[model samples]
Each structure stands twice: as C-alpha cells, then as structure tokens.
Target: MEDRSVRRQLSLLQTSFLLIYIYRNDSCRSTQFASTEGTTSARLPPVSKFGTVKVSGNSMLPAYRDGDSLFVSWVDGASALSAVGKSIIGKAVVIEREERPGIFLVKRVKNFQDGNYWVEGDGPGSTDSRTWGWVKPDEIIGVVLFRYKKAKPLVSE
Candidate 1:
C-alpha cells in the first residue's frame, strides 16, 4: 500500500510538471521580423505577438526585480522605425547590449534623436545610455507588456 501511494504521488507530480512546461513554452514564442540585407523593411508573415523573458538584475528596481519574468510585444528594428513610426519614449524595453553581444537588458526609453534611442534604468547603479551612449533601433528586442513574478515552491513539512 505504501509503495502504491508513493508511485501515485510521483505520477501526479510528473503530470503537473509536464502541463506547466507546455504552457510556459507556448507563452514564450513570439513574433520575429527579419530584415532583408540592404533593406530598411521587415519581412512579412509575423508569428505570435507575445514572448517571455526573465529579469536577471536590479537595474529596473521597483518596477521589475531580479528573477521576475516579463511578457513582451516584440518590435523588430526595421519595423520600429518604419512600420511603427510612433514614439517609444518612457516605455520599458528589452534591448540587446551593444558592448556585450547576446546579452539583453531592460531599460526605459529616455530620449530619441536622429533615429537612435537613449535608455536608462530606474536604479542608480544601472549601466545604460549614460555608459554606452545611444542605442540603435536594431538593438531593441521588445516592449514590455507585463511582469510576472515567480511562484514560490510549496514546502511540505
């Protein structure tokens, strides 16, 4: 009886994990617009509009803390400047750090001038436009839609 109970619990746990994984992956896929070489326009047929990214630092502070996950609406470089010709000032955005390739950072859009953007963090210690100067449109990955906090695991005593 004890062995059977343990097996049932394990099976239940596995099923729970599988369901969560599927849901999470489904929510994470976002639309991506790839620009053609030498062209300032994005290719057609955009996929889903939403995506997820995890925060890794305190740069955003009160607005977004470390370990928080954000759901964003992706905006590709060519589309941001051409297709969506609206101002993004004061909006939180995910940007690919110019100095450190492959690393992404969350910052607020502070200024826009001559087709470039200046971003800053709410936290004073953040490394942003003050350190790296203006960010090109191509560096912006997505606009933050909402933040999701990680759920704490339940402890069974």
Candidate 2:
C-alpha cells in the first residue's frame, strides 16, 4: 500500500481513457509579458486499461518508491518496442519477466541494452530488471503516464 486517495485515483485511472502529455512545442504570451505553459504533443496510443500502484521496494527507487502512486496505462504495443517507438523506461509496462511465467508483472521499462534492459528504482537502492536479467521483447505491455510522489535521484543510469 497506499492511502485511500491513491486507491481511489487508481480506480479512476483504471476505468477512464488517458493520454500522455509530452511536450513538443513552446508558446509565448503576446502584448503583456507572460509565460505560456509547456505545450503537450499528445499522440497517445490507444489505452486498453489503466490503474495505479504504490511501489513496494527499492528495486525501482528514484523512479518509484514505497507508497508512491503511479498512473499506469495498458496499451496494445505489447509484441514489440520498435513497433511502439521510443524507450519504454519511465513508462508503466505490463511485460513478462521469467520470474512469473504465466502472470504479467507491471513495471516501468527503465532502459534497454543488447537484448537486456536496465530497470531500477527512482528511489534509493531499488532493484529492477537489472536484478532479474533480460526481459524478452514479447513481454512488454504499456507505459506509465502519471505519478504522484516526490521526485528523487535515480539509483541506476
């Protein structure tokens, strides 16, 4: 766990459609001096499911922590990443890890390597895919779109 609010938030995210608000362009205020908010380039992939989870261990610290609520989105880009575009790190994913052959483990992708990915905690001393070894491409599911927690330095690069 998490608190009641986080649970409620997760329930809502699980049911509603969502989009990741990535910044693509910048806008400025005219006339009076003012600052425009960062613009978002939302080309959101279709959402199949959504939910929130409080990180339980340091395995994903710096990126996540115990009690941290994450807004996870399940999408269709499960079979491959080149098909999904961009790195899946910092994104919530439902990838298959040999740890649980039949069950789907949802976690952030973190980064990839020569067939292996380096996943760690945004918090201190968090273990991740790095601890578990390479995850097959067929395992990845989706990306995390939102989170509610204090930011911290990542334990792994």
Best TM-score among the predictions, by candidate number: 1
* Model 1 per-residue lDDT at 134: 91
lDDT of 1: 0.67
What tens-digit string does per-residue lDDT give for candidate 1 at 36-106?
A: 11112222322445566667767788888776778677777656655553467888887775565555678
Q: Residue-pair clashes per candidate, as listed?
A: 0, 20
**CA RMSD of each candidate after superposition:** 9.8, 17.2
What is the TM-score of candidate 2?
0.47
- CA displacement after TM-score superposition, residue 76 of candidate 2 (Å): 4.3
- In model 1, what lDDT does residue 74 have? 71
Listed in order, each prediction's TM-score against the native is 0.65, 0.47
In candidate 1, which residue pairs get closer than 3 Å at backbone N, Cα or C atoms, i.e. clash? Answer: none
Residue 129 of model 2 has an lDDT of 57
